[model samples]
Target: MVNDPHALHHRLVDRPRLTGLAFAPDGTRLVASVQTLDDEGTRYVPELWEVDPAGERDARLVTGSRRGDFAPAFAADGTLLFLSDRDPQDPPGPALWALPGNGEADRIAHHPGGLTAFAAASRASTLAWTAALMPGAKDPDTHAALLHERDRARVTAVLYEATPTRADGMDLGPAEPHTFVLRGDAPPVDAGAQGLAGAGDMALSPDGSLVAYTRAPTSTAPDTNVVVIADASTGEERRTFSRPGHQYYVPAFTADGTRLICQRLREETYDSEWQVTLVALDPESGEETDLLPDFDNWPWPGRVLPSPVPGDTTLWFTGDERGHRPVFRRDPDGTVTRLTASGAYTSLCVTPDGTGLYALRSALDSPPRAVRLDAGKPDQEPVLLRAPGDLGPLPGTLTEVRTTGDDGFGLRAWLVVPEDTGPGNPAPLLVEAHGGPQGSWSDWPWQWNPWPFVARGYAVLLPDPALSSGYGQRMQERGRGQYGGRPYRDVIALTDAALARDDLDAGRTALAGWSYGGYLANCAATRTDRFRALVSHAGLWNLEAFEGETDMHTYFREIFGDPRTRRERYEADSPHLDAENLMTPMLIVHSGKDYRVPTSQSMALHHDLRRQGVPAKFLYFPEEGHGIDAPNHLRLVYETALNFLDHHVRGEEWRRPGLL
Candidate 1:
């Protein structure tokens, strides 16, 4: 039950709720992007904040436009390089911009291919970035491209290099695009399969001749055969080593450039069993050794581990192998030493000198706060940094639960019961499923469904079914091809078990999810008309059509199997095939700008439901994409969904005027 507003996880929301925090070149100021949700609820802006580790609020508003800016990096000349969607000439996509640290900024380059600025470079007067090539751009889909697409329409990704200006201050002709694919029509990437694998964070070696990056198998098949290495000077790729059964997230070069230190995920979960490993790579020899192979992996699934101390071979990172993920150090001798011990930590960044560790720490009941960790003694407490506006403790109760599915597989979930739920009356149940059939929602702050549902006298069920991360490798890979088969069965089994209890309202059950969960909701609607009402966000309809339009069609075809080849299987499992069976009145939410699942899927379903005379309404958020980011839009979405559920399920007349 969430009585405290911050009942989810303390470290997740704690003050100086640091995001996109980067250290300046001289380590003078820590630049971070702070998300502030305003009063009107329409404008949620993330402003640039610069704070001196010693507690200075020199935070300036670098981004002045209506569009959001984040992922700031300080260039060699002290100019700030960042990603923004405010380019005057381009559509709503990330573009590289250079802003003077002291004065007004100017546009550097406009990527026609769309922005995927995972990494950028600026040395002397030259500026470079790694991005995706747009369709119909230069011949980027040549043999040397990393992305392998079966069809051009469905292929939305291609690696590119952008050179803003040469070292001589002269504009370097035009952007040079290079596809990482093999030469000459090798075969397009399979649908539902990974084309070319890539690294999230990349680093240019000190010499600038070699590029070091993390290489994970592009496919989501749990190919731990991934590792970080440097591209050879001969234009050949030299793999350092393979790290099977683990994920290598962020990579950085050592000061010497001969070795690479990367943040490796030891487990999918963040709690007691999770571990973050710091591995050292010998680029020249193509060899790698885990500095701490036996280290305990933390429960934080997506948080990046801090790179090892700049010049030191002994890697230092913040992880809680002892309890929660806390700071720890690994000696060259493989002896794992625990660092910061007290509160739960979610994210941290260490300076190049290792003198200070900027961390975001929170307790079970406390919101996360920024702290500067000084490597001294265990008894030495960290210096508290910034304290944003206070959001008093949430009014709720948080309980961790472990439930097993029909297959007897262990499922981990959180049950948030409202503080107002008394012993006599069983609270209405609302089951919230996470997206990313491959993504996990563990230790995540309650922003939308769970929090709001609990506030309205509903118990939220967040079950980490077989496919969710945080458990282990096997758990995540369990429901791969069993999309509508096992996973759906698991959900029903879990719900049935829960409904059997006298504490939950069996007649008022409501199901909700986004992306993959949307697909699941579609399945639930058609497979069984158990729920009184349904809420689907960006739901996927017509998997057959999706295979042809989705960017990763090749990959999807592989997993779901080319629906054409396996038409029977596809139809039998796809919600679109059995849509006629759906009897529940459902509200479908979608963003017109969505590319991952596309708006067409939703449109098709809406039209069909209307034609069939089924109770269905489609809500389109034109100004948004995938998920609603604007505060006003978010409020509208949440309020509309709740009103719909209350009217249809709770038997309450809560619809506002002109809601349709």
Candidate 2:
């Protein structure tokens, strides 16, 4: 249906996307990692662009190559440093490159393996990064020797000694990740440690003397996260902040370097509420002071604003509150205030003086766009920086549907109604279940977006039900231990409430979901036949089967107890137990490489449906994981889902996608 390239939301993947924002220390310019579609349209290529944060002039691309550049960072001497491919033959070299304020770019360092990520101190000359290194290798020569030995021995297999053999991005490697430090003209040093949690968890002190990185729990200590502080130059361990049943990561040094700011979330039972808070660590005394204790905020561990001015460490961070993801500023004197009024924000950066703040804000109807915030103003509306990813006028208008749940709890959802929706021409309803049983429909989504459906004359309802986040832990507690009970009630209750609107058609309705949402979609199909058709993407069918083969076996054990011992809870939430009652048409979507939910869940569901004579179809992505990643695959996803809905709900002829 969205085949036309000029269609409103057809080219969302082809647009020039912006991310990885960096502001120069002097606040003269801001650089961002912009991804543009290649000439062949096979993949997106990254390049560095300078955005005018002050909104004075247009943004311009700074560097270019066939292999592309990304992960922009700045050194204290006004030198711009980034990562790019140094060897065209190798492709994606991820070698460190530096470009001075007024000079040609030159390669600084290229590790044996490709670079995973890199970072530079906000106010210091020291630079540090993480890359793949042969396990147990001490130095460059040692790493090279180990690689040679592996090749000589013809060993190409992995022996599992850890619980997480693979994750979303990479496999458990023959060469593990390691850290490196680069300071001035000196040669880079082997830091003898790993950053553990990507570049976000690593921090460099303002003075550039100390580097702080997080150490993931070893086999012996499997439940705690350790924050390690070390000498930046020598890589000597200085101190550690760790405790059992607690996590301490997202490290950031205050402007003075005397104190370190980080987030800590205690390990609680499966039914307990997870309330992560911001804390300031006394690097010398080893004491932590709660920074945002009074506010209802769950600090995002991925990013924290870095203050460039010394002794004046005013921090800005985004937190989940209700449905909006807004920015909150914490002053040195313990005063906490929200700076942005609305919309979800990420990639927060600040000017050198800490007076100007910059971030990208997005909503259900809009895509991510660069914006500036006044640090001095509280609850200020952000000023648009006018960069790329400009979605021209949408084909729909957005509204919210609010009501009370069966338990007398407040419920809400973002309702996207087509522009032509009216009583005489009501739009068909499509209720989309959000992934992450705990995640809310708070931010903009390029993948699970609603505009495309609305453009096709569908009114989309995105509900934050009992298990969703941003509404305090009690909301999740309401559905915890019983995903199919209370959360399903909230979902259907909110859907019925939305159908009561004049612009929506109650007679024609469908359901679609992924991950945990997919599980709930299956539950809805079995419990009630109100939905004309249901689409489940990577959803769990049998909890008992999924608990053993899924990636996070321990996580499931803690959530519902071991199915081998306490099988009651596992059997209670599983959708397969009630599959005999399913009558609605099902479009089961899954991937061959999905370790999170496993492909077996959807396979079993499709088999059961066919044997029972229930109309069903299974769509598979052989190379994709739990979620489809490639832009080409995503286009197929939308097309296939829309085609299925059109046939089953609208009573039109079913037309399969080309790839199908």
* Candidate number of the best lDDT: 2
Candidate 2 residue-wise lDDT, 346-388, digit = tens = 8898887788888888888678889998887977899998687
Candidate 1, position 369, lDDT: 63
Q: How close is each model in CA RMSD to the real structure? A: 9.5, 2.2
Kindly list the per-residue Cα lDDT of model 1 for residues 438-519, writing each as its tens digit: 5554433433446666666787777666566445545545565666777777666667666666667787888888888888
In candidate 2, which residue ranges exceed 4 Å CA deviation? 63-67, 89-92, 148-154, 195-200, 299-302
lDDT score at residue 382, model 1, on the 0-100 scale: 68
Residue 201 error for model 1, in Å? 4.1
